[model samples]
Target: MVARSFFALCLAAVAAAHGDHDHDQDPIAGPLQALWYNTLPGDGGTQADSVFSGISTFGRLPYLPCLNHRGINYDIAFIGAPFDTGTSYRPGARFGPSGIRQGSRRLNLYGGYNVPLDTNPFNSWAKVIDCGDIPVTSYDNTFALHQIEEGHFSILSRAPKTDATKKGPSLLGKTLPRVITLGGDHTITLPLLRSINRAYGPVSVIHFDSHLDTWRPKVFGGSPSEVASVNHGTYFYHAAQEGLLRNDSNIHAGIRTTLSGPSDYENDGYCGFEIVEAREIDTIGTDGIIKRIRDRVGTSNPVYLSLDIDTLDPAFAPATGTPETGGWSTRELRTILRGLDGINLIAADIVEVAPAYDTNAEHTTMAAADSLYEIMSIMVKRGPLSVMDGEKEEDL
Candidate 1:
């Protein structure tokens, strides 16, 4: 009780201070449109700006996240969970989200279908913003888990959850913003899913990974024990036991590994929707994959996409702990992302981008950033900028 009360007071104080700061910074730049630096070729990094310059007036800023278009402020928070403690082998994913965001300098607002940019369809209904990283401890294992659990729940409350917007915040008449997270590793998704399930009923997960993380007690040795297996290897099994996942709707993509989970597949379930090898990418392609994804998850269901960096080929994403050789290329992965535009995706996480493996640090973070852009583009196309001042829907 004391901890909850103290946290609540801290939140109120932080909110008050943020309100004052936003009021000051926002008036300088009225609306956030993708600026010129974004469109111009040969741009170095994400350029932070207080004013909209260049052509089209839709330059995506680097430093500042979330925009207060019109009178309402959208909470498109981009939080980083740099947690590598749960990892069994490699352990530098804590820097994954930030590294990706840093590399996402030029984001494509238009879909590959060549959707006209001047009149993009998705801007009206959504208002996206990046809230930055949550407050968490770095080294302390127990403290990190507690912070990841509590810290994310607070951010989750700010999201629209089931409805398009949330009520009860001081933001009042406007819609509460949606929070997007770039996780440290796959374990971060467990706490995040728990928070979302508590707010909204059982949600479907569209997971993309190289391995099946459904083994409850991961054992890598002769049998499935802690000595053989560890934390990062078993998320799906834990989530299912915790009842945070809807087994029917969950879909796993770009999987090119051999997993041996006995009862997880539900009589040949394939350990939560496994797509072995590059065969799916070759035979069905992105469109076929998208259709299959939509078929499994359905269109209207809210989705939380957890994309492990190992899903990409080692040539493209070489910074993961377990890198499979014949994974899909980056462009192939991007095509899958663009195909799923406007499919009720709530939040996303790009995990397992270990910077240490890549001496150049080019492929891993770059691929991860590009994957994150897919979610950003999907959200942007869903009317993030076009949403008007909406009264909080009580029933929602």
Candidate 2:
């Protein structure tokens, strides 16, 4: 199964590289893209049963685990990591996953396209399921970290391992479960890496954030020992040392500030990353950032994307605990993400959304939601959903 999936992935990647086309008129549309509510015969109601009558290809919510017309499972789970214990400045991110889940139900399930929104190496199969939040405490950072890790371990274990004697929770039941984890803080990524390595071997990380979060163990002041505090400030060093992420694959896109101890590492010569500082994005543009990211992660590895909400400027995203001055604009982020239309993204997380910090929950949560949407788009772009074509023939 693993070998088959890998082969399929390779073929998809080649297609995405060569099948590049314009979006104005789609040559390929599948059942998922079949119109459901576009100008009904006589009914112009606002609800589903009335406005959404008929057996359109799109599945109903509480989406069942069934094969679609494209022959893929409906697998995508929304898992939450409520551990702000690592947050440096804010204490409200523990509430992030729950809020984002609530917000998600309020929007269109597929961004109005039943076909996967991803355009590269067009994904032809993926099943998305919202598995709900990972259970953990708010104040206990260590406990929260453990809980988040365990939850993702379950997610990564979605694919059956021949080494294991018993059947385990396989991703979307057949493939790696496409997980979009809602974060408590940047530190939540440590546990997540543990799981990804277990499931797919050591994978590369494509990190996007404001601060580097690579402060050495025991470097943080609040902790009695490095293990004592484990604040959001210390994920990279922990993961790098632990062999969870490839430093070469780890690209830092929006760093504007420095940790008390990690200055020497960010120096272009010191760190093996294209540390594109916040202001440079405008002058350099997202295309450069995307190229740098591709080079950093390499086209072959399955990349994990982690978005620390602080990567955005506080003016645009003020809900984070740490608000940096210069950061990526929403449009800038969208451009970069859209450019990565076909990379095989295994899992993604959005961290540091402190609802308590903003006047209107401006920064963290909203950006997290938008960031999640981008991730969702990325998943569909890289899976079987990508190449699935021919929007259901207008309900015959």
Candidate 3:
């Protein structure tokens, strides 16, 4: 009887020890338990239901409805200027913003490339939000331009309040949210420049295109009764005439299109921009091209980069309205852009992506989307600009 009682006591002790050991072990061991632990109900919990539902925004990012342009709480606004009335050849770039956004879905939350300068902008300190397409007037070009300018101005006019104690990338000790515009067409750049010029007078331009786009406005051949005639090819001419460009600092790269006459070059020169022909890539090389760009723009001037999809050879990007045969390849453009780190880039746009012309591969829109990401990475690395009393000043 005593032996039986002792055996029962020993079994009880062993059971207690085993229970204690189990209690000390982690509750979440297998994949199912880990998933359950991570997906609990509350803040910081994963919601499987809303994983990928809803309207697709840029890069599938969180959509902040900015219909009235109020409650703006982001460092970078990805806005769509969806009007292609300004196109000279094709009429489908109005769909560019959507196409670019769709292509961006393929990008993960990691750095775009393996290069030293290719960090992910979204993962940086900057807060970005997609503020859907601006409501442009389909019938009236002047009204559409006005709306586009106002949309940009509304975002630029207000500077986010930053903690003065912390030192980081910002404009004038404050954090002013920069704008990365997904364009309708190249002509949209004219109004964008207008809005930017209002805040930081006469900034330099880094124009990438197959054509100079500095053609005379008379090329449009509109009646005197019509609204101020403007097209993708001639907006820069107007921009120059209005003193909105730093003529001595602006530049055009990857131009291979035939000029109307020698006066075209003369006019472009008068606007204060040097041209780097497409074939020059072979002669001077990528490094030399980057040097020329940096030397021309300098380090202090506020720069606006406008990339026309036509800058890529049609073989690679055939969806643009004006595809030149001899142009920079995708790899060359990526290297050149990566080399342009540390420039004071304030505002940027990627335009002229007519997705309708894109092949089954969707190469044009994908290139545009990737190029946009590259530009955004550059901006994030540069950080915010220095503004003083509602104006952008050169960094001291």
The candidate scoring highest on TM-score is 3
- Judged by whole-model lDDT over C-alpha atoms, candidate 2 comes out at 0.62
Weakest ten-residue segment in model 2 by summed lDDT: 387-396
Query: Each candidate's root-mean-square deviation in Å?
Result: 16.4, 12.8, 10.6
Local accuracy by lDDT, each model: 0.62, 0.62, 0.78
Candidate order by TM-score, highest to lowest? 3, 2, 1
Off by over 4 Å in 2: 1-46, 49-74, 109-111, 114-124, 159-174, 259-263, 266-274, 359-364, 384-396
**Higher-scoring candidate on TM-score, 2 or 3:** 3
Candidates 1 and 3 compared: the better one by lDDT is 3
Worst 10 residues of 3 by lDDT: 387-396
Q: List, residue by residue over 1-396, the lDDT tens digit for candidate 3.
A: 999999999999999999987784432112233455666666543222231344667766667766575766676788899989887677888899998887786554332333557466766656777888888887999899899999987876665423223332333334456788888988899999999888777889999998988887765435243455687888898899999998689999999998668888998898888999989999899998999999999877778999998999998899887778989999899888888878888788999888999999889888988887778888777665543222322331
What TM-score does candidate 2 get on C-alpha atoms? 0.71
lDDT of 1 by residue, 14-39 (tens): 99999986774322222333565567
TM-score to true structure, per model: 0.69, 0.71, 0.81
